[model samples]
Target: MTDMPPLILWFRRDLRLADNPMLAEAAQTGCPLLPVFVLDPETESLGAAARWRLGEALVAFSQALAAKGLRLHLARGAAGEVLERLARATGASGLWWGRLYDAPAVARDSAVKARLRGLGIEAKSFPGHLLHEPFGIQTSGGGGYRVFTPFWNAIRARDPGPARPGPARLRGWDGDPGAGERLADWRLGQAMRRGAAVVARHALIGETAARDRLHDFLHGPVADYPARRDRLDRRACSGLSEPLAWGEIGPREIWHAARSVMEGAQDPGVDSGSDSGAAAFLRQLGWRDFAWHLLYHFPQMGARNWRAEWDAFPWRGDSAEAEAWRRGRTGEPVVDAAMRELYATGRMHNRARMIVASYLTKHLLTDWRLGLDWFADCLTDWDPAANALNWQWVAGSGPDAAPFFRIFNPQSQAQKFDPEGRYRDHWLKGVGADDFYAAAPLRWRLDPAAPPPVPLIGLAEGRARALAAWNAGKA
Candidate 1:
């Protein structure tokens, strides 16, 4: 309506058009809108497997946009510079986007905001990625809660504003913007090769698929999430982690849908609000918030432990044992299966994460940071907050942590969770009894008679050593 050209909506983590505060704001501008997605070489240069999933998500998003006669413009380079160029090219008055909370993202956004302001272009951000902003929820003492329980308590006490509904309509700039690289030009799927091809054969990949998955879980697994989530063999887990990670589905929409159903008490048979299933599922969402809070408060948390003293603990780096665990070849069946699951599917179940993390840090006596790095590279859902916090939790070096002596017995974990051996069989041994276990990657292999490839360093020894280190400021 104004004499100036349209506003630029820079898409980052919030990839979908639904319930997005930023996109909603952009639509309100009523000016021509240039929806752009920048592939910052610094950030978008993720590992091969991550790229594969990203490409799929992008393709899905592109299709969604195309259906409405809109397109997501892709550009690659430093964010601030790329955005500045985009603004100039589009003759835009302002740039809009949702917030990102990571340290690197924060720094980048700050610079971009300053640059835009200098050019008299408004750079605005709204909340969409997280339910509660980092500073939104606070304790009685007027500070953020350090531990998760208190954090969650504060979160529940406060009302999250009603989620904005999905965008019902869209408008566009008259002139088409210049194109960036083709999706296939990025070659994100190169690393996984045959695995990527195979997974795509059966995987649903996009925003619509993500919504369907959410509905399916609500009707099925989520009803029993609390009781069966810890069981590795049960299909009770929602498997929505990756889609959530990819921003194919917004958390607010999920929250609203679940809460509405619970409030209605629509199905008396459903676990809904009354049982552990709904509560447990809600807790995972709480965890996502808690991790973001930690990252926001302690920016170094992404790279360092929450408890600083754990920094100096001795770690046997690149040892045969460590490599074995990395390669999914640890003689321990459960741990091996978990690593393979990660390698094959770009995700591992919640219980499996703890099992494998504990086996590496406590049993193998390796440093937790190394394991964290591996997960950072491997997990499709590798949120820095969740990955770092969960790793530190298992390593006994986090704010709320298990004691050093409480080691997980992988065998007991397998026996309890995979009682039917289905999980172990699926990845390690295969579909049937006749399917033999494949040879693990050459890095870490321990034959049954071999003495751990390194000494056992009994749990007691490891605990004593770890505790002493903790007391001595090196936990």
Candidate 2:
């Protein structure tokens, strides 16, 4: 409505068209907008697999937008520099985007905001990623909570409001690009050579697909989530992590959808079973929020252990044990399957994640950071906060930390949760053998072996060695 041309909606992590507060607010201005995605090369440093997933998400977003008469303007270089040039070329008055809490994102955003203001271009960030902003939830004494239960309790007591979907239509603005690497030229998936094919085989990306997946999970597995969530082989959990991580789906949307079913009952006068599944699923979302809170309050959490005592813990540095864990050859089927599954599909079941994390840290006595880095490189759904938080949890160094002695016995875990060996055989079969490297994804292929290497230390011995290392480090 104002004389200012539409603000450029600089798309980042919040990629979807629905339940996006920033996009909704920006659209209310009636300004013609430039939807832009900056493919900064710095992202390349994260991992080729991560970049590959990101590129696919973007391409899906671009195609969806194009169908609706809007095309995503892809650009590359430092974010600030790219935005400045974009502003100059498009004659745009401002930039707007959903906020991200990761350290790298925080650094880039701070610099970009200052530079945009300096250039007389308005820039604003909105809390479209997490339900409550990172700084929103805190303790009674006005400090961060270092434990999960208390932190989660604090969050549970609060209310996350209704979801806001994006505007149905936009009077899209034409924009000039200063520079951009062609999507194909970026070749984010070149390392895998079959990256897109791999992702397509398992996970589906994009708004509509995410919504459908959420609905499917709700109608079935969600009802039993509290009991079955940790089951590695069962479709016991929502496969929503990839979408949620990429912001292809927002927590707000998921929250409300699950709540609707849970709140509905044949007898409205009293509470019913409806709230159970919703409550359980919401708890996971709470954990996700808590992870972000930890990262925000303790910025060092992304890289350092939450517990200072654990800092003294000696960790195996890329040793054979570490290598064995990576190949799922730790003589632990559950752990190996998890690692192998991560390699094959760029994801792992939540239970599998914890199981493998425990094997790496408490069982193998390797640094949690090593496992976290590998996940960051390979996981299609890797969230900086969630990934780091969970790793530290298993290492007995995070908020509401797992006790060091609580090691996961992988065989028992598999027998209990994956009793049928369905998950194990699925991944193992995919690679032709338990240790077949020839057919394995290149990411999992270590040291040029014909078949993938098999397990080294038996489960019991690995556990003993890992615990001994922890005790030694403590002493």
Best model per lDDT? 2
Query: What RMSD, rounded to one decimal, does every model reach?
Result: 3.8, 3.2
Per-prediction tally of clashes: 1, 6
| Tens digit of per-residue lDDT, candidate 2, span 1-475 | 3345657888988888888888888778878777899877557666656778888899888887887677788888889888888887777878998999887888999999999889888989888799888788778999787777777777664667668775788767754444556788888887656545655577668898999999998888877887888777777888898989889999989887876767672212112322366677887888899889889888888688788887777776788888778766775666767777777677888888888888788666788999989898888898889998998988888878788889888888899899898888776665423333432566654543345445666778878887787677767
Q: Model 2: residues >4 Å from true position, as ranges?
A: 1-4, 178-180, 266-275, 430-454
Question: lDDT tens digits, residues 38-149, model 1?
Answer: 8886556566556777888888888887776677888888999999988888778899888888888889999999999999999998887877999887778876778887
Best by TM-score: 2
TM-score of 2: 0.92
The C-alpha local distance difference test score for the whole of candidate 2 amounts to 0.78
